[model samples]
Target: MINKKDIKTLIVKKPLTLDCGRVISDFPIAYETYGKLNERKDNAILIFHALTGDQFVTGKNPVTDKDGWWAYAVGSGKAINTDKYFLICANVIGGCMGSFGPSHIDPETKKAFGTKFPVITINDMVNAQVNLLDHFKINQLFSVIGGSMGGMQVLQFVSNFPDKAKTAIPIACTSSHSAQNIAFNELGRQSIMADSDWKEGNYQNQNLNPGKGLSVARMAAHITYLSKKGLENKFGRKLQERDDLKFGFDADFQIESYLRHQGSVFVDRFDANSYLYITRAMDYFDLPRKFGGNLSKAFEKTKTKFFIISFTSDWLYPTQENKDIVIALNSIGADVGFAEIESDKGHDSFLLDVPDFLNVLKNFVDKSYEELIR
Candidate 1:
């Protein structure tokens, strides 16, 4: 079992009020760092992880023994080159990766928080993570970057602290969660809740693993991360093991087996209740609504350079939604750049090894660094 002691964390002693009107302090924000912080501290980049991602962004996760989630795009000489930049990624407060979450014991009852854990929002996540800046003594970050829910955190981070970052990159995400997004997330949550092993989110106390339900949730959500064309190109109608149909529901197709493997492995590393909490946070994200229904207002008084990206095939957070952010920034006469890269991969294009994306991202960050410092 992965324990909190295995991960590095920052214990936040100062109380932080959440959007849900709860105050929490002395909680932990689990994190990992790469590269060295420069004397000026301007090279620091705060990276935010997507829904299931942890603080392990660019190296082998000590706990999972698996490649870090952003291994392809980050590392010594990759796009977000650690050779020239210092990177810090925090496991969001609602995460399971040794961060403050439902799995942690509540001092009052001396039991796991479970469903009693207060509901968090995208705003709450960024608010808690911003403590990292103070902890690291960084007055301003060189950039704030993330994709999907991470991207939402990036938006909230910049909005909440306009002057804290010099540049902001929100990729393959939306300022507002759509109804379709909520529906898909709800499906995953319901699948988990439906499992008897879930035990009403108190399964941790009972020592019953809600693996089946969490696996199903992961499987359902995984489908939304891929595109129709990408799925067809990769799996199509290929058989898993035997070409002949067994007629039973035993994963006859390659896609079924692939999804099953994805789901099963996910439960080994993730907590079921954390999944529920994080999805609710994602579903509640509405940046424009928070800013008086004018997304442009979210960028007011911020000189942070903005570079937004989207994948043409990402129906989950479509290019149009990304364009909406660009349109809003443009309306406010904010300095902004936008790109919609062509890819067969869906919302997951940002995470995969897309050369076009890697190059574009590298060029933007590097060029911005040089120009800013000059």
Candidate 2:
């Protein structure tokens, strides 16, 4: 229920050139800012959000009645320490939250773009953000930080614009999407497209929405976001609003209630077609080939400092992946640090209130800032 009134849109004709050899014309990128840019324009920190996150990262979402997604780690004195840095968060180019995507009207057909939105790559996404930065007149950023898909963008940003950022932090991310990971995303897309109500991504005008498909997709994806230990600790065999088990697919356990809540809420805010587009973009992201088919060559000239973080229990992108990235960075003799925080919270731990992660974030930002100022 985002109030169209408060939302401001900036449109760029042919904003991003897709890796699929198509150009996204007359695109709009939705963004929100916190704090003030310094006179030198060097205090700006770009914060990238994951698969489902929007521009509303830290502040309260007046439109949804829910607290901002990363409120716990952002804000005045939080881990990001916005009070000390100029924070910029934008909905990725292919996202649905106020950004141009399938739901947007296609000037060519005078209809919703729907599934016709050009396929994009993570580099394309970072390239769009660079265009937005140009529009804002930000020549350089203090740091770029993100998790999950957001982390993928962070890494791509460094690879694409190595000299533009003072530091880059890619947490809970990998150098490339694995076949197994791509399979998971493909299943989600299949769920959405398989729904009878999807109507080939034209459901919006057909008076039908692919809520069931989107919800099921969300449910399956949500499981990957948490750890088995976390699930057991939070909702192990717990009954759901009942004393006796009259199990007939009626949410017999607390875990079922949790997953149902995640799925239902996800459908209300997200567009099914955009989900397919964004995930496809992530699947197509790989830097080795982009860097002339050698991962080590990507960072060969990057002067930007890097801080790679991962979690022990994150099965989605394990610590091994982070280590491989570190190895590549080291092979190029890049200034990089790796911190694999011991946590059982899984991939979602990056966004959660993990004290260890917070300490690392604070330390990395402070250290990077000191290096820049000195």
Candidate 3:
């Protein structure tokens, strides 16, 4: 069980109006910090978490007792190098981890808000997070960075607060969620809702955990994170435990077993309602469309240095979508740099230990710091 007291929180007394025209105040924003903030405070980097990620960015997650999601890329002497920078990661509003979400008891009804939680947008998410800057007294961040949904937050952050970050990195993500991506998210949502145990998202009140439904949703979404080549190379036609196909739809292949494990473990850490809400927020994201169909205009006012990354095998966001961001920044003459990394790890590549990705990222931050000091 996650002990809420173990998590750090900021209760924003300021009311926030959501995209759905709902106003919430005094809500908790759970976060974790790493390293020490120097006297200059300019060494701070605010990292946004992806859909399934929490405030745990590096080291051991207190709640899960597992390696943080970006453990391979962050820490002392790693890419982000906490030894030389202050890192802050916050659980997004609609997240399960000690943050304000549907799982929280509604003050009015004294029951879990469940689906009654106001629908949030990527815009609302970033706006709420910007309060962290005020909390930390950081005038400007050294950089704002993240991958996938996190990457979308990076873009929205820069667009919403043009002068708040010195540099930005949006990795393996799209400015707008693609139709295919929306369809995939919908499949996950439907899988969860289809389970009878869900009880219209009120399972918590009835002591019923819709684990089966949530597990299937996770299994479906997990497949989208990997490439066909990656899956074949890793799991192939290998049998799970038997040599022959005594298969009656019973874990015949290693791939099936692997996916089952992923789904099972995911349900232990995630909430079903959160999965639905966050994916909906992602599906609703369309930065270009929000800015009157001109992507360039979104960043026209910001001078933040951009370093966008995309993997060769990431069909979810794809190299083209990442490049579209680059093209838009370039059209307005924004300081932007891009790299199309050669990898078969699909959309999940950015979270893994890809040497080329790590090296370029490290150099950019270190060199950018040198430039900042100079």
Candidate 4:
């Protein structure tokens, strides 16, 4: 029940051409800002969110009543240090959170775009962000930071607009989605498509939402976000309530109950079609392929500093994947710092309270800020 006024948005009347040859005119972008821009406007930090994250980065979300996803790491005196920097986050083009997406109405047809929304790539998402930056007159960003899919956007931003950011921070992400990563995305897509209520992605007309399928998709993907050790430590074959096994199909274990709750809660806030579109975009991301099969070439012309990080237990985007990026950066002699934090928290470690990770961020940002001012 989020109205347009509830979130700050910018509407671009100019037609935006997509990578898939589709044009969207007069679209809206939803965003949120923290701190304030200085007179020189050089203290701006652009942050991107993960797959299901919105523009809410450090405040209460009016729509969900939930605290911002990165609230712990971003605030006045936190790692990012909003007191000393201007922080901005925008919902990507294919996001369901007040942004133009499959759930929004098409001015021409007067109905939701749904499946008719053109397939978008990671590049397309970055282009939309560029437009938003233009609207705000932010010629350059102090730094660009993100994790997971957001991390993909960070890589795309640095490659596509080398001069727009002074520094780049991509955590728990791969330059290209691996075959296994693509497989997981495909599995989620199939789960949504298999639901009878999906109705070929036009469920709105039938008044029957694809909640069941979407929930199953979320449940499956949620498992990939956590480490096996973390899961074991959390649930550990514990029962949901009763000590005895029900021996039935019901959720007899704590893990099953936890996943079910995650799925159910997700369906209440996200759109099924948006999920499909965003996942497809991630699967299509291949930085090396985009730049003549030379990942280093993607940053050959740039002088932007880099801070890449990976979690030890993050199988989704393992330390080796991050090292590959470091190798490419080193091959071109690009200024880069890479860290593989030892953690049992898995891919979601970046979002959790990891002291080492926070310290690294604070140190990098502090050093960069001092250098910029000097």
Candidate 5:
């Protein structure tokens, strides 16, 4: 179990600029640190979390008394290897996990920002992270590593601050949100708002939550996180807890029971309004938009080495997305390597116990470290 008493929260009391031409000030960033920061501070690894992730990257969660989400990749001898590298993970802006988000109080109305929170882009999330880094006096990072939405932020960091990181690893991600992706996100948003209890995003004041709506949304989205083969292999037509199906509103299938459990646990740890804000931020992410819609133009000035990894079964952001990032990087002569791991775990493969991917990461980070020193 991780020590909760020592868990500290740092706040940046200033407004920030957003991609939508809006300002967010007096913001507070919540973060957690593991391992000691060496004198040089270059031993630091900045980790960006995905849509529903918090700063509890490793160690047990204080709130729920559960294991950390990514403990598999971030222990003493793990891939992130806490013994050697100082690790930092912060709850991103617009996140529900201790960071300023829709749940945070708005200075203007002194109420929760709710739907009034400005829409943020991946660049904006990176900018908020920059503030957190400044607070910690980390001028540069040894590496920036992330998966899924976190990967989007990683790309944003390398593009915006080319000199800040020596290496970047963006796993199971796209350079930008595709139109189809946006539509899927919108459906989730609509499901949340459609709940009568949502009360135009003011559900917090009434102490009511759109639990059913949020669960439905989660259930729908979680399906995209896996491949058809994975789902089939894991659950298929297996019956749940009964020899024969009742066939009437019962969780007759194993998959249905699993999904219900996912939704229930997710609602406990996450806020509904935050779900809206973060998803919207993800939908607006477009790396090439900053450079006249030319994807290659985005990496023209960067010297950062990139290791882009994708899972063969991850339809959410398939191997093609990784290829596009590599092609663009190559267009500008950027140092880049791409790998597509064969796995049935789909988009969640990176977070799972995959020896092959872990070995690749170990080698990649080690090589980058050697190159930087030489």
Candidate 6:
């Protein structure tokens, strides 16, 4: 059985080559593991988190004092069934939570990397995870599963390491960011850069942070994660503890109050520069482009079984986008499954409590495990 320990942070001493020709050396990766790896080590399942998610996937987050982001879908006997599989989740390198990012210190200058940090792509994040897996001596993964930005990493992992994972699941994401998606990310980045305290991404040096700007950015991005139907169902024209309009800009509506709260809570835990870097990485992600405009070529040699999912209300990554991925996989005769669930939960449905989604996930993992053992 694998020994359980507190969240572990490992420093990769070797230089990591990036697509932009930049290199990162001696960077730290913070991760948390659930369950135990058996003697064979073939039962390992690597889970990649969303854009803002961290290593804490199924337990109490020591830093946030809150339940894990995906507690409902992962854990012993949950959809992922930690009891049957060794689950691992790590903070992506271009992330703020316990991974190498703009918030990390550059050994050369002894200051936060900030804008000075080399630009990273989804592939870079997957490369970091591969290095981490190498550290653990795990040659083949039972499965790789993720949604949203995490799903992007899932795609990257399968494309770059075709023989590494036996099964791959990418949910509510696309191989490349859509024009609308890039516009939304650009808006968030602009919000941070427009903040007066941002100080041109050197706010750390001035002992100031762009809390307000980052908060606004979070508020804006949070809107995209929800569908109009879901938002109306949750907060539809409700007032925020007020009887009527106050005739002022002090959050007269319940939706406004809820969004403000999201923004406020986010700024406390995430770095503005990290937000900038991670969003840029997403905007630059295009698996087909990297493989010379042949999406099928990216997975032609892969033996991995893929299960792709999309939510009906997820406009950020609509069902058509997922269908496109399925088509590409089909073109190459790759083993694949596609599910477009009927849900009003929007792009965030994968992370929320959706019975249908969870059941699908559980069945897929169970079947994959069954095939592995046979």
Best by lDDT: 1
Worst 10 residues of 5 by lDDT: 1-10
Candidate 4 regions off by >4 Å?
none
lDDT of 1 by residue, 214-302 (tens): 99999999999999999999999999989699999899999999999999999999999999999999999999997789999988979
* Candidate 2 Cα outliers beyond 4 Å, as residue runs: none
**Candidate 6 pairs with clashing backbones:** none
lDDT of 3 by residue, 196-239 (tens): 98999998888888888899999988898999999989988999
TM-score of 3: 0.99
- Report the lDDT tens digits of candidate 2 across residue range 182-255: 99999899999999999998987687889989999999999999999999999899999899899598999999
lDDT by residue for model 4 (209-271), tens: 899999999999999999999999988999988989988999999999999999999999898
RMSD of each: 0.8, 1.4, 0.8, 1.0, 2.1, 2.8
The runs of at least 3 residues in candidate 5 whose Cα sits more than 4 Å from the true structure, single-residue gaps closed, are 1-7
* Model 2 weakest 10-residue run by lDDT: 1-10
Worst 10 residues of 1 by lDDT: 1-10
lDDT agreement with native, every candidate: 0.94, 0.86, 0.93, 0.90, 0.85, 0.90
**How many residue pairs clash in model 1?**
0
In candidate 3, how many clashes are counted? Answer: 0
The residue-by-residue lDDT of candidate 5 on 1-374, one tens digit each, is: 12435446676767777878998777767788888888888788899999888888888878667778788888888888888789889888888777778887777797877888887777888898888678879888899999999999999899889888888999999988988888778888888999999999988867889987888788878888888999999999999999997969979999999999988887887888888888988988888987898888877777888999999999999899889999999888899999889999888898888888988988888778777843
TM-scores, each model vs. reference:
0.99, 0.97, 0.99, 0.98, 0.96, 0.97
